[model samples]
Target: MNIPNLLSTMRLILSPTIIWLFLRDQTLMGYIIFGLAALTDILDGFIARKYNVRTKLGTVLDPLADKVLALSVLFTLAMKEIIPYWIPGILAVKEMIMVAGGLFLWNKGVVIPANIFGKVATASTYAAVLGSYVDRTIGLYGLILTVALSIVALFSYGRIFFKEKV
Candidate 1:
């Protein structure tokens, strides 16, 4: 695997570990590990784009890794009563729709790259997860922003999918 792909795979693997740490009441450890995993997401994308080493696997795996990590963290936080359950619930449903749409587009030989809105949403989500460790209010606001941006991203993706599919 290329460096970018490897990084994405590492994030995917680290996700469950982060969740485990959070579940075990290891917030500090979980936060540190989660930060590292989030860094991989940024690094992998940068490497892939800058080096022009983007692959179909990287294209798919990168976002998949982000989704898994973000969703898992949100779910874990909710389960721990650190965040509202509806936050993760809404995000889970949104992600499921995104995955299904992405799969359909992939079958049709169309690959839609992540847009700015989606990037911001993912970043905000990471911030929210991190902020939750510090202050619940900050986390709540961050998640609210994430949900809004994610909805915009979903619409943007849907627009692109239709435009390309047609």
Candidate 2:
């Protein structure tokens, strides 16, 4: 019950709340929840590192929560036609590819701890999707940032691919 795990659980709980708020068209509440969730996202990492409380569960759950929250929001927004149709498609596809690769590596016994670039991409995605819930037009910059961060994350994975013996 460290701060990191608590924050991760908070995010997990927030996901369905966000979806319900979005479904009810309660855009402002959705934004509030999303922002709080994002703040917890930042706080969790700092708490984990600051307190030396990092756990394997936190390491795994934090990123999975991020992906689920973000991808779900993107899908919800796309379904509402609030943003470009292709944005979610591209992000989801890339996410799936990376996730599959990660699972493959893990099956072969490599933990592949999360990297800085992945955190950046997750933050940008939360920002972009939350922005869409408020003003749908406020998406371009976040989208661009997501792509930039994704590139960095992919490069890190590339290094693992090139260097890992397995």
Find the candidate with the highest TM-score and give its number: 1
Judge candidate 1 at residue 22 and give its lDDT. Answer: 93
Instruction: Score residue 18 of candidate 1 by CA lDDT.
Output: 95
User: RMSD, each candidate, Å?
Assistant: 0.7, 1.9
What clash pairs does model 1 have? none
What TM-score does each of the candidates earn? 0.98, 0.88
Model 2 off-target regions past 4 Å?
A: none
Candidate 2, residue 5: lDDT: 91
lDDT of all predictions: 0.93, 0.79
lDDT of 1 by residue, 15-50 (tens): 999999998999999999999999999999999989
**lDDT at 147 for candidate 1?**
93
Report the alpha-carbon TM-score of model 1 versus the true structure: 0.98
List the candidate 1 regions with Cα displacement exceeding 4 Å: none
Give the per-residue Cα lDDT of candidate 2 at 28. Answer: 82
